[model samples]
Target: MERHATSAELKARAKGQLLGKYGTIIPAILIVEIIMFAITSVITLPLDTQTMPGLIISFIIECLLQLFAGIFIAGQTYLYLNISCGGNIRVSDVFYGFTHHPDKAILIQLYQLLLMLASFVPLFLLLALWMVIDSLYMLIPITIAFCFGLVASVIISLMYSQSYFVMLDFPDFSAVQCLRFSRKIMKGSKARRFYLDVSFIPLYLLGFLTCCIGLLFVIPYMNTTYSNFYLELMSKRNGGNVQ
Candidate 1:
């Protein structure tokens, strides 16, 4: 089996693509953050969050926000993909998901969310049992369940990390098909993906050291690199021919 590009190579490609583009990328990232902040602020303004009903409404709102965020993320992915490929892209392109097959985007996100929840079901069940039995022995099983759930959730997430990219590449495919294809291509490559992610920790830490202002730059660089990773993975799978 062939290996993908090293993390340094991918990041270098991302950096090269990002050169002179911060003028567009930074503002786009800010727009996304502002929009999310404004939506949360406006929606929760009238509600007394301390009350039970208000709390429930808040939870529902959070869930809806997550659903909407999925679409936004697809749009972001589209923008990054274009940037990485040197295609024409506008800051407004960040909203592409809303106009382009939003249903599929939402469905993909919902499916992933459900899978994550399902992964934790065992942990939930064991915790519930421990609550009822009130035995010290139950702690061992609960701990084991928690560990298993965490590992499963992480695996599932990594497996489907490329779903949005797949969706963009194959617009005709259904959400489930996109997910299945992502998992297929991701086989034996999750560690590569995970390592690539870990490699960004220093940049994230640097962003934090800058009072988060640097994250505006880091976010797009990281996203574009991940986009490159997806492209490289696809290129490898297709005999070095990236569509």
Candidate 2:
């Protein structure tokens, strides 16, 4: 039998998980992410110029930075998920997540980077054609492109949502297998996942409203909460305890 959780139950689980682990891990994760972003910005700065060469260089540098950041973020999520299970949460757990499963973590990161690039190709081509056409006729293809692009984005989100956990918990599984497993878990549960995504909208808005300072709290809160939600869902499906 398939198992399910209501939005309220998920939210409660998230809250409990966040409160339980916030003091031990959130600060470390935030610091690591901030440092990674800063380093990425510094490495890619020269590539952001207006020239063609600069643009090309910037694109390449940006892609590399995203790959690096994805690894760090995915590793952090893995550590957090393990903690959400039975393991003790520690600052070092984040580092261990990378060291212990370096290859899988990097592969997962690469997969994410590729998906991001793939998602933009169509939109990029559509816009390029629009610039060339520069007319009402361009709107037709652009609109169609936009709809397909939106659907693709959602599908990608659903497919890869649980990838970090898969990499962490099921190290033997390949990236494609992990992605397929995530999609299967999400199947017949689109409405719940959509609601979960929607629930984060207010947090994002709050962050925006606060000049992004709110993110310091909101990001950790959301990450921890979502980790718990993922654990609960998996536990129910496998008929196992959360620990």
Name the regions of candidate 1 deviating beyond 4 angstroms: 44-58, 130-139
Per-model TM-score, in order, reads: 0.91, 0.86
lDDT digits (tens) for residues 177-227 of candidate 1: 999999999998999999988888998999999999999999999999999
Instruction: Name the weakest run of 10 consecutive residues (lDDT summed) in model 2.
Output: 96-105
- Across residues 1-243, which tens digit of lDDT does each residue of candidate 2 receive? 656777777667656666666676667767787788788778876564788788888878777776666567665786667655656767766675557656666667677667766876887898988888788877877888778877777777766788877766677898778777877776666667777778889889989899887877677667766677678667877787753
* Clash totals, every prediction: 0, 0
Clashing pairs in 2: none
The alpha-carbon deviation from the true structure for residue 144 of candidate 1, after best TM-score superposition, in angstroms, is 2.6
